[model samples]
Target: MYFVKKSIVIVIGSILISLGINLFLVPYKVLDGGIIGIGLILNYLWGLKAGLTIIVLSIPIFIIAWVSYRDYFYNSLHGMIISSLFIDFLKTNDSLFLINPVYSSILGGVLVGSGIGLMLRFRTSTGGTDLIAQFLCDKTGINVGILIFFIDSFVILLGGILLSTDTLFLSVITIMFVALTTSLFTRNVVQA
Candidate 1:
């Protein structure tokens, strides 16, 4: 039933997002946004595990959701845990295929965005900053997509300062792709 469908979607979405990170973004030092970006920054700067970093960074947000947004907490908890674990586990795998950094960024964005959109469609997501964005969206009536893009851009800018101009440029392209794809994929879904 609905639970089974949601589970399957979450699993598939998590795998796709993990593949995008492990096979494309990580190799090139490109970043997505939100907790994932933070995780990547930690990995780049300290050799920390990106997934573990995501989990750690997400703790405060999850705690907030648990207290004030129980439905969101219930919906997103498994998605967050599964996706984070998959991302960490899949990091050991070799890249699926070699390609230019630009192409990798685009493909990574698409994969990650599609995964996120799919989960959102099912009323679930990988949590983290996404939950914050959702809460803001509910209160402000702004498009969640736009909020996510702005948040992502801020992260990428911070990353640019810490990483490289190339990282920033490529990440901008990646986030744009993610925004477009997520919007398209979630057109009929409830707003996140």
Candidate 2:
């Protein structure tokens, strides 16, 4: 039963994240944070597939997780791979969610936040820098959410410089929504 529930969470979470990225974020050249943000930067810069970049970028993080947090390694590998694949698979569907960039940022943030939040609830996540944040949280006893926000902010700053000023500003909105929505989903739930 536990396995089944986690599998379901991964699938739904991956889909929501993919839709949010390909449909909402991609169209506006906006970005999420962490590895996904990096992936978007690559995509915007070179037409690279975001999912592939995420998978490739996540390798080192997963290796670290394997060395220290065995459970996180085993659990998040599937989430990372599936979400990355879903991001690429859904790339062809980009025009599906066209809207005002601000609206896109809010809705995209909510979708991604919900996906990530659900996975985190199940003790699985899309890994990448999220895994790094988790590792930092464990070692430093910092709040995982705060760490994630910081990582995300750095990514947004880099993206704004690489992409455009508008990307930086809109991405701030997206991250705020993502963080808020993630908080809502994980509210009262014990962190794993």
Candidate 3:
């Protein structure tokens, strides 16, 4: 029963993430943190696909997890692969959401946050920011969420400096939404 429930959650979570990427973030040109954010920034600079970049970037993070944290690697591998595939596949459907640029940031934030929360609830992660967060937590005994925020915050700030003001503001809003939605979704999840 637990396995079934977890599988369902992963599916739904991945859908939310893909929706956030294709419908909200990608269309509006908003950025988040982690590998995805970097991918978006690169896309802005180099005209690359953010989804494909995320998948490729995740390879190194996965390699690190596999070598340094076998348990985390085992747990997050499926989610990382599925979410990456879904994000890339859903690009063709970008017009479905029909949201404005600002709304896109908010919606994307909520979706991404909730997705990550659900994955974390199941003891899984998408293995971009989470991998780094886990490494920090393991090494420093600080909360993973806080560490994630700190790291992402730096990226967002850099994005602000490098990009437009709108992108910077949207990134902040998106991160806030991600944090809120993740907390709301995983409020009752137990950590093992």
Top-lDDT candidate index = 2
For each candidate, give its TM-score against the true structure. Answer: 0.95, 0.95, 0.87
- Backbone clash total for model 2 is 0
What lDDT is obtained when candidate 1 is compared to the true structure?
A: 0.87
Compute the lDDT for candidate 2: 0.89
lDDT for 67 in candidate 3 is 88
Off by over 4 Å in 1: none
lDDT of 3 by residue, 1-192 (tens): 987887888788888988887778877668888887887788777888777788898888888888888889988888877887787777763377776778889999988888888888788888888778866766876656666667777777777787778888888889878877776765565445
Clashing pairs in 1: none
Give Cα-based local distance difference scores for all models: 0.87, 0.89, 0.79
Candidate 2: list runs displaced more than 4 Å.
none
TM-score of 3: 0.87
Model 2 TM-score (2 dp): 0.95
